[model samples]
Target: MRNDEVLVKVEGVSKKFCKSLKRSLWYGAGDISRSVLGLKNPEKLRKDEFWAVKDVSFEVRRGECLGLIGHNGAGKSTLLKMLNGLIRPDEGRIEMKGKVGALIELGAGFNPVLTGRENVYNNGAVLGFSKAEIDRKFDEIVAFAEMEEFIDTPVQNYSSGMKVRLGFAVASQMEPDVLIIDEVLAVGDLGFKIKCFNEIYRLIENAAVILVSHSMPQVAQVCRTGLVLKQGKINFGPGKVSNAIINYFGIFENNGLNIEGNRRGEIRNFKFGNNDTSVELDISKNQNQPEIILENCQNVFFETSVIIEPSVENFSLIISITDIDQKVVAQVTPPERMFTNLTKMMVVEAKVNSLMLNTGNYSISVHIYNKSNAVDRGEILIGIRNILKFTVKKQKFVGAAPILYESRWKEC
Candidate 1:
């Protein structure tokens, strides 16, 4: 790698955690263990040795955003801690090019007993800032944190949001060469999250960023590259943001979505995909529809699979489409939407009169139910299947909302 090309680099890093009871003891390890073991009902000895991270290595260039995604206990947090220099890796080396600002946990660098002002200065110093420099950015930090009135109050009196706000404000001002953030951003209100994203976007223009978030949309929006960690190693990485997400969800399907013993309804199968990339459809923008020739669009169709649960009675299917704002855009009616008194496989179909959506994104929502009241209804209590999302785009804007396609532009 060239000198100016990389801002942060890690070569073959690994971290492990011990689950031993005696290992955690200081001096009287045997005595404590024997005492506990000799009790009337001795506690079971659980095996130790869990590898949180194994041989993980990747480099991040300056002004690049990297997303770290993994299942719970996938070493994402441990890797982040090592990057922040809070913990040392058991193996391999990490090289950083410049100062780092990290928001690993809420209230990480705060002094509970000290006033907010003091904590700000303390955190600034921890980030290697001088008193004068902290003072210069003090007002901006306080304003951004929205804690001016309580600037003199001790941190112990602050709420979680306040703590996160202060921490984010201070870190935002550090202007470090790299920033490492965990999923704590999911806390706080929606507006705060939006503000944080804006600030982080600005920071990414000058610094390398490593974001660990559970929200897939946030990860896709900010990071150009991502690594999907499975068990303890990097399972996928250096891939397109969308592909990384698909791969990450693949882990869940393999593990999280596995059926346990048995539930009310048994799910047969499912499918997921993007209908079109050119349209870029989401809930807020356009319904996920392909460009229609208006005349040829007598029927614009979306596809989804139908699953029948075991012994479900009077079962039926439901399909719906909602805008990016989650408002219902369209839905297949029951007579045209449902399957009755049948098993095996059912195909769901929806027809649209015309596709007049503006160039935007939209989502498709589907549901399955039992029509107990109807005599011909197939009653089966299978769990609701996954949502199907697609995108629709065009060269020009057609209508204000999806359904308002045939409006006039007369100046009369």
Candidate 2:
């Protein structure tokens, strides 16, 4: 098929499962009997049955990669299994054009007793390759997996990472017209994961790819379009990957301010804002964490007052910014000299000029540390994680970087 051709198409597909295993077996037998008798099975949910994937529809062209993202148990894997033909949807139709390669689960198609070399050929044959074709691609697959020395080992003996490397190598090297990858890549080491992403980029040039992952960065890096599933239904997209990522993060509620440290200090008041906006907190109400919205390149300022015990002599204030994954993206630390004078009560403030974070949700963490103890050591007098949350909005979604630096450009 041509590059623009639609290789995978789904129309309102839905799948349901029974919660009880015994009931599930009974229902399966009844469905089989009805099928043999040429009677249509019921479409509605029965007792203890629930839809795993509901009314999902989308199409993938030959040169496109669709990022399917969601929280755990959001039916992402169920939809992928349906698309890969491992299972059938109960309610809709699916059309897949050409050879479909999948690494949906670790060691999914391999026989544990078989050697890696034997399983490679077995998988190639399952993908409709003949002996000659498998022979031509065999060496390349082994080298890509870096399993040349372990090719003769049984797959059961291979580590999880080894299985992931071998499985990804076979699925990608075959050059199938459609590739479906689940979260199996998370098992491999970072180096191999990078190699897999590079291969995925090359594959999507002429093939239709469907990637299901919880890693938003991975989805943003490789996918042109995205779909977010929530509770077996579409929560967002068949739209921009960035918006889908934002919607995915929106599924979880933000945590309240969590303070941890020695009792030497207590935060009395905290507030923050940008040049165009400011937020004041009322700690007496015991309210949920406050959220602030800011435009791109806005200046951010934060101020807090802390009451220290008499024994505490000097302390330094540290502010850290974290993304939705709770990964620290940016941090601000003042010079130690700023806190030399001893005081029982003090107000500290910090400012960030022209904040350049990408469009996403971020949280602030405040730390008060004794100046004499090293920052690396556990010398925190007081610390609050998720003390405040903020979102940066932009007109257009740029590439997924924690910081979108405004670099000066010139032609030489």
The TM-scores of all predictions, comma-separated, are 0.69, 0.89
Residue-level lDDT tens digits of model 2 in 273-386: 877888877544668766688874567788988887778677778889998777899888777473743555577888888668888888888888877344353478888887
Q: Which candidate number would show the highest lDDT if scored against the true structure?
A: 2
**Against the true structure, candidate 1 has what lDDT?**
0.70
| Cα lDDT, all candidates | 0.70, 0.88
* Highest TM-score model number: 2
Candidate 2 matches the true fold with a TM-score of 0.89
| Candidate 1 per-residue lDDT over residues 1-412, each given as its tens digit | 2424688899999876667656645323553576678733122322465668899999998878999998988889899999988888767899998788888888887889999999999988888899999999999999998999999999999999988888888888778888888898877778889999999999888888999998877887899899999988999986766678777876754212212222444343333332322222232232333332222323466544454554654555555656544567766556734355456555554555565555444554545566633455343354332244455556566644566456668786
Clash count list over all predictions: 22, 0
> When superposed on Cα atoms, how far off is each prediction in RMSD?
10.4, 2.7
Candidate 1 deviation (Cα RMSD): 10.4
Error of 1 at 151 (Å): 1.3
